[model samples]
Target: MSTGVWIDQIGIDLDAGTQQVDEAIVVMHSAFVEYGHQGQASGAMVETADSLRAELSTGTRLGLARIGGQAVAMVKYRTADGGTLYFGRLAVSPEARGRGLASALVRALRGAARDMGLGGLSCSVRAAETRNIMIYEHLGMAIIGREDRRSLTGAVIPVVLMRDV
Candidate 1:
């Protein structure tokens, strides 16, 4: 298997199936399993492949990272009100954790935002997940504010809003 990671923006094909999409769904669900067990499952945990396909039909773009031609990490993003790229559901497979795959995906999305003339990158992280927040901080993002996001189970999750600085 190749040790190098490949990162890129994927254009969803609403009319046809794509391996990248399938791989992304697997990576997402697998990566979020911990959240599900913790009773704080994210909305992404409930998304079926078909639902994800529907979401992609709405112009949401995916950033994917692959190692050895196998998808290992993924992020979903869209342009928000302020011309900033609002990304979420960042997931890296357990086997790929600590390999810098998440960081690579973020960098790729940042480049994508720049290419689309977007102003900046933004995301919300569960406030309790300080490790994730720190990762974003290491990537040049900072906490701008906080908000409570209701999860699928109606649990109010405290999240911190972060933006590239």
Candidate 2:
């Protein structure tokens, strides 16, 4: 049986295919670069193909959306505390951001998480990235708390944790 479905023409795969995972990595790296994010600067943000392979092997559920031979958006999810599903590493290609791909990915996760018998989806976004914060808020996520994340460069990253409202 297929474990994924197309939502808004986006491929939302929980049991990811090999090429889907590879394309996810490519999309993630490209999106991170476009956002001026340095993958090596943060241990939490290991944005490389090998890193993605390692994470995928460790039980991360990969979800991806592709168009015209390449991934355009993606996200990762795993079981977390209190029976919640923790999701992160959400990335959308620069050219695809405003086309509602990110929101579609989030909605897809809601369905996926519920289907897995999980409570809800949890995620964190940089506190300083207000644009992202607003987007999450617009998507029905409520800011729950703040966390200081450690990076490889000794930078204390402030992030806001959010959950489905």
TM-score of every model versus the real structure: 0.87, 0.85
In model 1, state the lDDT of residue 108: 70
lDDT of 1 by residue, 1-165 (tens): 122234443222212233457778998989988987887777777877777777888977666676666777777888999789999999988998988777877777777678778887999999999999999999999999999999876789999999999
Note the Cα lDDT for every prediction shown. 0.78, 0.75
Question: Which structure among the candidates has the greatest lDDT?
Answer: 1
Quote the lDDT for 121 in model 2: 80
Model 2 Cα shift for residue 133 (angstroms): 1.4
Indicate the TM-score of model 1: 0.87
Off by over 4 Å in 2: 17-19, 34-46, 152-154
> Model 1: residues >4 Å from true position, as ranges?
1-19
Ten contiguous residues minimizing lDDT sum, candidate 2: 35-44
Query: Candidate 2 residues 1-165, lDDT tens each?
Result: 246667666665666645566678777766766433543344434656677777778887787876654578888888887677888888888888887888887777877778889887889987877988898899889999999987644677889999987
Q: Candidate 2 — number of clashing residue pairs? A: 0
Q: What shift in Å separates residue 123 of candidate 1 from its native position after superposition? A: 0.5
